[model samples]
Target: MVFGYFSNKRREKMLQQLSDSRPNLTRAEYVNRLVKKGFNKHQAEIVHDVIREFIQMDNFSIYPEDDIHKIYAVEDLDDVELIDVICKKLNLREVVQEDIDELDKTLKIFNAEYILTLTNHISV
Candidate 1:
């Protein structure tokens, strides 16, 4: 069966890896940590919700420092969909290469916090 954009085997492997590496935190604690890191509550929530929906994972399991590349394969159709969903959810302008370059990092190294920061500056 298909799971999100992943095949069943790929999805299961991803979920298993995530479960093994997941941080020990409640949802409230996770969000609070994001806010403590300078992300506003709404931004944190959006990141949490979007990631949870995107990967079909427990949102609290995701950490700001978790590398997006490690979470899933990059430059795939799913990657594009993730960016689109985040932009739409945050009402942000379309993401461009300049914006990614402004972060001084490539998509290969992006994490949840980087996403929040990127979108924060891009919001309409």
Candidate 2:
């Protein structure tokens, strides 16, 4: 897996160990806790990024940034915008619910309002 989120070898090792120990934790759960424990968003992203690659069988290039707003506003990250950043960095098009409980849990962690705003432009 691409532990690209951690630049520090020590932190990456810690994250890898945790991943090994907790194979059942949802991605958002692990990621949210990691952020709470001082892992920045970029670091959390690495975990999701690699996992997305692992699960993405269709090679979809456009992944939305939040559970609600599939329509991510691109704030000019060079040639590619926010959605493009999500695609290039994470290769995701959706933040799946997996289950109702999991969906609610992630929504709380990520903030439902922000997710709604970001995903507002997206379609089914």
Number of the top candidate by TM-score?
Answer: 1
Most accurate candidate by lDDT: 1
Q: Write the per-residue lDDT of candidate 1 for residues 9-112, one digit (tens) a residue.
A: 78568657776776566667768988998888887887777776776655336666677666644445666577778888777778887877787554456677
Per-residue lDDT for 14-58 in model 2, tens only? Answer: 445544554454566646755665544663566455435543322
TM-score of each: 0.72, 0.26
Clashing residue pairs, backbone N/CA/C < 3 A, model 1:
none
How many clashes does the backbone of model 2 have?
9
Worst 10 contiguous positions by lDDT, candidate 1 = 71-80
In order, the Cα lDDT scores of the candidates are: 0.71, 0.40
Candidate 2 residue 108 Cα shift, in angstroms, is 7.1
lDDT of 1: 0.71
